[model samples]
Target chain A: MTVARAVTCPSCGGSIEIRAAGYTVTLACRHCGSVLDVAHEDVRLITAYKRASANFAIELGSRGTLLDIEWEAIGALERRSPGAIWQEYLLFNPYAGYRWLVLADGEWQFGTLLLDRPEGSLSSVKWRGQTYTLDDSSEIETTIVLGEFYWRVARGDSVQCKTFARGSSYLSSEASGTEVTWTQLVPIDRRDVEGPFVVRQRYKPRPDLRAIREGYSTAPGMDENDLPMMFLVALGALFIIGILQNLLSGPSQCVSNRFDVVVGAADTTHKIGTIDVKRPWQFVTIKADTDKFDNRWVDLDYSLVDRRTQQSIDAYGIVEYYAGTDSDGPWTEGSHHGETLFARVPRGSYDVYVDAGSHGWPSDPRPDTLDPKNPWSAPSTVSVWLAACTGGYSWGMFWTFAVLLFGVPCLILWWRHQD
Target chain B: MSKRLILFSLWSLFLIAISGIATWYAWSPFADDERPTSSAFRGPTHK
Candidate 1:
C-alpha cells in the first residue's frame, strides 16, 4: 500500500486521512463529520454535520483482500431510498483502481464502476453480451458521508437510480443533473467480506437499521404490511352496506292460515291461500307452527305454485315437540315452529298448499290399527299454523362472500406480521 | 394512490358490485328452496 498524507480537520482540528490523495476531491472529517475540499492545495471545509462518525460496518482505512487483490476502504456513503437504505464502502488499490462494496439487507455486493455505458435503455440493458431486465428504480439520497471521494459528495445529494438485473448479476445507473454513471454489481458472499474486512458484528445492520438509529420518519406508502388497513376499510364499508341492505329489504306482504291434522289419521293436503308477490325479484319465507303435542311430530310440505307458469317452488318444515323424563330429568327436544326460505322468487300470485301429517314417537302404526280405547294412543288432533311472506334475505351468504372477498389481504397481513 | 391501493380498490368495488346485485335480488346460494321429487324429502334447515 502507498503511503497517504493526513490533514487536520478545519472544523474540529481532528486528524483526517487522505487515503486516495491525488484522485480524491472531497474528504469528510473523521471526528467532526465535516466535508472538506482536498482537490486543491488548501484543505477547505465544504459542509458541516453533527454526529456523522456513526459506527460503520467497515471502518475507513481498513485493508481487506478481495478477488485476490488488497484494497483499503477509503470512503463510505449512506444512501437512502423511500423504502430502503444501504451503505456503500469505497475500496481503493493503487494498481487495481477503485471498487465498491455495498451492504444492503445485511448482504454484500461487489460493485465495479463501468468505464463505458451499458448498451440499451433503463428497462433492459446489455452489458458484456448479457441482457439485464429492469428490477427497481427509485430516487436515492446520500444521507451520510465519511472519508474521501473522487466527486464533491455532500449530504442530501440525490440521484435517480435504476437497477437492471439478470439472475444474480445486477447493473445500476445513477443519473444526476449533468451526467449519468453506471455500475455493474454482483452478489458477493457476506462471509467473504466479513472475513477479509473484519466488519464489526454490531454494525452489520439490515438496511433500515441506520434510519431507525438516526430517527428517520417516512410517509405512509403502499407497503404490503399496510394491507390490513385496506382490508379493514373494505370490511367497514361492507358492514355499512350490509346494514343498509337489510334496512331496505322491506316490510313484507304475507298470507297466513291454520289447519287441524288428525293424529294417526290419513295424511291430507290442503290449500293454504294465494299470496301476491308484488316485486320483480324477492325471497319468500314459509313458516309452520303447531300447538304443543308431546311424543308426536308433524311434518309439513309446502308448494308455492306460480299462477302464470304453474311452476311449483317446494319446501319442507317439521314442527315437533318431544318431551320425556329420561336420565337427564325433564328434557324437551325440537321446536314447535320451523321455517324455510326461497330466494329470487318471481312476481306473481302463487297458490300455497301444504301436505301435513302427524307421526307418533318410536313407532308410527297404521291409521286403522290405532284404537280410541287405547289410553297411550297419540293425541287425536294437532293444530298447525302456516304463513308465507315475500321480501326476505340471507345474511349468512352475504358475510360468507365478504370473508372470501377479504381473505387474500388478511392472509398477506398475517404473513407480513409473522416473526 | 399506489398501484396496490388501486388494485385493492378495484377488488373491493368488484365485491361491492356483486354484493349489491345479490342483495337487491335477494339471491343466495344458501337458499333452502327444494324441488319436489318422488323421493322422500328432508325437512327445514336452520339459517
Candidate 2:
C-alpha cells in the first residue's frame, strides 16, 4: 500500500497532499494555488499564485482503473502550441510508475515513457524495428499547472517537441535545455478511456459542412473558397444545357441507304439520298452500321454536295469488328457501328454520296462466302448502312465543355487528397 | 454566397451564356473545321 504525505504550503499555509510522496518533486497548494517544492524536507514555495483552481475533465487525486491497474491522476498540465491546446494528465500507479494521458482535439492518447531512446534524427526514427516519419514539430508552452508532478513543472514552462508517426502510433521527443525525453503514444479509444478516467465531457466528431456539400470529409486544406461548389454548379448547369440542346436541336432530315460490297474491294462512290438543311448552321451526323462479319472491315467517306453551289462538305466513318480465338482465349477488337459528327454545316439542298470499301485483316482474307443478297452470313460480304442527318447536336462540344467545367474542381480535390 | 463564390458564379454564368450564344449559332471551338482529307475512320491498325 502506498502512503501519502501531508505538508503545509510555505506561501499559503494550506495543507497539500503529495500523492507520490518521495517520488513527487513538486506539489501545488489546493487552497491558494501556490506551487511548492516538496523534494527537500521543508516544503519551499516556488511560485505564489493567487487564483481559483481550474476545473479539469478528470479531477486530480481521483483514482481510476486503467489497463487493469489502479492509477491516480496526480498532476495535470494544460499546454498550448501555435494551433492547438491540449491537456496532459500525469497518472501514477505505485507498481506501474508513471504514464501520460494526453487529450487533444477530443482524442485520447496513452503515452508511455521510453526506456531505450529511438535511433536516428528528427526527420525519421527507428524504434523496435519500426520506422516512424516526422509528422509535426512545434514549441509548446505550459499555460496552467495543477496538483503534483515528478519534475519541477511550473506555469509558463515551455519545450520544443517533435512528433514522428507510424500509422496511428506516435513517437514524441520533447527538448528542454540540455534534457530531452521520449514518449511513445498510441491512440486509445474514447470509450475505453472515458469510463476508466471518469471523464465528464464526451468527444463528438465534428462534421465539416463544406465537406458534406462537396462529398469529401477528409480532404485536407479545405477552405471556404467555394471553387469546388461553383464548379459543381457549373457542371450541373452544363448538363441541363446539354439535355436542352439535344431536345431542342430541331427536327432532323435524314437520308439512309444500304450497300453490299465484297471483301478486299476498291472504294466505290454511291449516291444514297438527299437531305435538306434549313438552319443557318447545323451539325451533320454521319452514321454507319454493318452486318457482323469476322476479320473484315467496311470504311465509308461521306460528302454532302450543295446542289446550289456544287461544293461539298465531307466526313468519314467506319464499321469494323474482329473476333478470334488466340492463345489468351477469345479476343475481340473494334465495333460494328460507328458514327462521325460534322459540326456547323451551312444550310443547303445536298445530295449525300458515300465512297465505300471493304477490306480484310492481314491484308488478305478468305473468299466471300456470304452472298450479296443474303447479307446476314458471317465471314464474308458486308452490308453497310450509311445515314446522314441534319440538325444534329454536337456532343463533342458538349463533352468538351463538360470536361472543362468539371475537371478543374476534380483536379483540386485530387491534389488536396494527395497532400 | 461568399464574394468569391458570387464572382465564380458570375464567371460561370458568363461562360454558359457564351455557350448558349455559340450553340444558337451552331458554332463550336471544338468543331472539326478542317476539310475532310483522308478517311477519318481510324481502324485498329491505321498509322
Each prediction's DockQ?
A: 0.24, 0.30
Cα deviation in Å at residue A371, candidate 2? 11
Best-matching candidate per DockQ = 2
lDDT of 1 at A373: 79
Off by over 4 Å in 2: A1-232, A366-379, A411-418, B28-47
DockQ, 0 to 1 scale, candidate 2:
0.30
lDDT of 2 by residue, A26-48 (tens): 87778657788899998777765
* iRMS of candidate 2, Å: 3.0
lDDT of each: 0.78, 0.77
Best by TM-score: 2
| Residue range A197-281, candidate 1, lDDT tens digits | 8687786655577665343223233243456567776787578667756754554888899989987566799998888777677
